[model samples]
Target: MLHAFRLAAVICAVLPCAALAHPHVFVDVSLTLRYDAQGRLAGIDEVWAYDELYSLLMLTEAGVEGTVDPGQMAALRGLDANWDPLNGGRLTVEPPDGPAVLAQPRHLSTQWQGNRMVTRRRHALSPPVAGDGPVFVRVYDPTYYVDFAMPSQVVIQGRAGCQASLQSGQTRGQDDAYAATLRAALAQELDRAGPDDVQVDIGAVGADSIAVSCGR
Candidate 1:
């Protein structure tokens, strides 16, 4: 998925302004917040389901065709080789009191779910975050070039007293508004840009996230 959109980005540079106004890849995410027996934050298990277009692109890139089998699914597992470190592998954990670091994703796996491609992986929180305060997990691209919907399903494990809540950041209405704003901005930037250079800095202003709180 990452590689697919990075190529789109390059194409956007020379295409019409409309092409640069929205994300090229869409993903729906699910998360499992894990805690150790000691009740400290251990890691997160995540599943990402890509939109059909991107899924097809991914499969084609992997040299796969229709009706993917188990062996083909297994072969597609480690495709995150193009994951960008700058985006924290498209995820991050925000502890209530400290700075969040880029997590390393492990145990990569993938499968075909109908027309979508679902990928799973783990992000272990080293040193194990210890606190009763809420910890936030965010799935987003700072530049908004890849739109990742926050976890639609959240599960808690190993912590009986912990509760997880989903907080949506960008609703469809809000995204429509944002896209309008971005289109105008991109148009203005393009007017002032050199013939071959057009750059605009987009931040993750409305990223959706999940929060988990545990009792002592």
Candidate 2:
């Protein structure tokens, strides 16, 4: 997974004029905020629908283009296991003092939706938190490698009178300029930065984020 990410980063950096202009892959995401019986925040349910091109590529690579065999199932599981949605700091949850980092996702699975791959997973907060106050959640690919957007309003569960809405991020020109700068910087740091060192600025790309308010 790290290798793949680095390779994509390099490709985008090296061909910023062409490749960076339009992302190679796209995903539509929806987040469902879950709460425990006590009304404390429990986890976030994520659903990602990948683009047809990327889905085909994944299926080809997995050698499960025609059937859903055992090997195909295992390959899908491998993809889920290798994917750390927040590893690139693509997600952020705001709390009182600071932001909350999410734990490894649970119940991650991928299925075919026509020609696309729809992935579902649950991400638990490191420490359970109260559903009160305004909780902000942002999901974006900070490196601008792949475009992610929410096609629908976020769903809130277990919290009464909770409402969520999406906020658009930077303007097209601003986002393009930012992507260009990031590509140039990444190109220079490709050799110096290890996989773990590669980071994305979630805030920079968090123009389209979900803001949740739990009314009393």
Candidate 3:
């Protein structure tokens, strides 16, 4: 698990933009949240799942590891990482620097509102370098995440449902509208948070990255 954390920390750093290439993608993603036994997020886990893969990618590119599992690995885009001495912390990154870093509110939590958790979670800040997100990355673990609308719903490769998730309710042309509504609700929730209570960043990196490191 520690190895996976180290690997993911590295991957999110290297692939700052997220590299989900398949439509019917099955990513084993997870989050390292500061939670209790009942399963509640109280913190964040930057590095998880992708430790070996990242090391392998480095080896494959360097010609050290001969014959890599192309099927086992997906392409990563941007996952930059940065180490902050002032905060004594490291962060994964993509663009616009990184996500805001703050603390999760003592009572802040995600509440299910209809099909999704319409409430904002006081998630940990994204790493200055290798951060995470898709609506506040690393806030919730795989079990808590509802992103996988159809883990078994396989569509054609490259098609919306086949490779990537089509959002919570984006089946029809109104996907745009649905997304807007969700974002609006999220923004409202985030708006009430204190700057020191949470961090904000971007990187719609698919659940694949999140899935890989659920327990690590």
Candidate 4:
């Protein structure tokens, strides 16, 4: 997914304003908040299902047709093992002082789910933060290079008293502003002989965030 995001970022950085408004790839994400036996927040399980178009592109890049062969599947697994999406600054975990960074992921795997590519991974929360109150988590590419949606409901595993809710990010006006900013950045990059120094925080455009509350 990060690979696709980077490719889209480059396209947005070099393309004209007309082409910078839309996302090149789309993913539907389902996040599960996991708790340890002692009821402490241990980790999160994420499933990212790629859109058919993007899945086809990935298959083509992997030199596979129809179902992936064993070699192709191994290659996909290797890609997931090497790419650490949690540290990409796209996922944010709020814990009062600031956003908390998660630890390394486990049980990371990717496979073809029907015609789409689906990636599943478990990200261990650093320091094993307790879920005693509301925890805000947002999964999105700050650049908005790849649009992410939660089509399925968020699940809380092993905690009967826990509940999760979705909060929509970005109004129509904010989305428009985000598109304009991307266009401007891309244009500026094209004009400069060297790399442009401008930094765009596309996070302001809004994000599809989730709030998890555990009642002890």
lDDT of 1 by residue, 50-70 (tens): 889988887888899867898
Model 2 bad stretches (over 4 Å): 1-21, 69-71, 80-89, 171-199
Clashes (backbone N, CA, C under 3 Å), per candidate, total: 0, 2, 45, 0
Error of 3 at 154 (Å): 23
Clashes of 3: 45
How does model 2 score by TM-score? 0.75
Regions more than 4 Å wrong, model 1: 1-19, 87-89, 171-203
Higher-scoring candidate on lDDT, 1 or 3? 1
Q: List the lowest-lDDT window of 10 residues for candidate 3.
A: 153-162
Candidate 1, clashing residue pairs?
Answer: none
Winning candidate number (lDDT): 1
Q: What is the per-residue lDDT of model 2 for residues 117-154, given as tens digits with 9 covering 90 to 100?
A: 77887889878777785777876665455677764587
Better of 1 and 4 by lDDT: 1
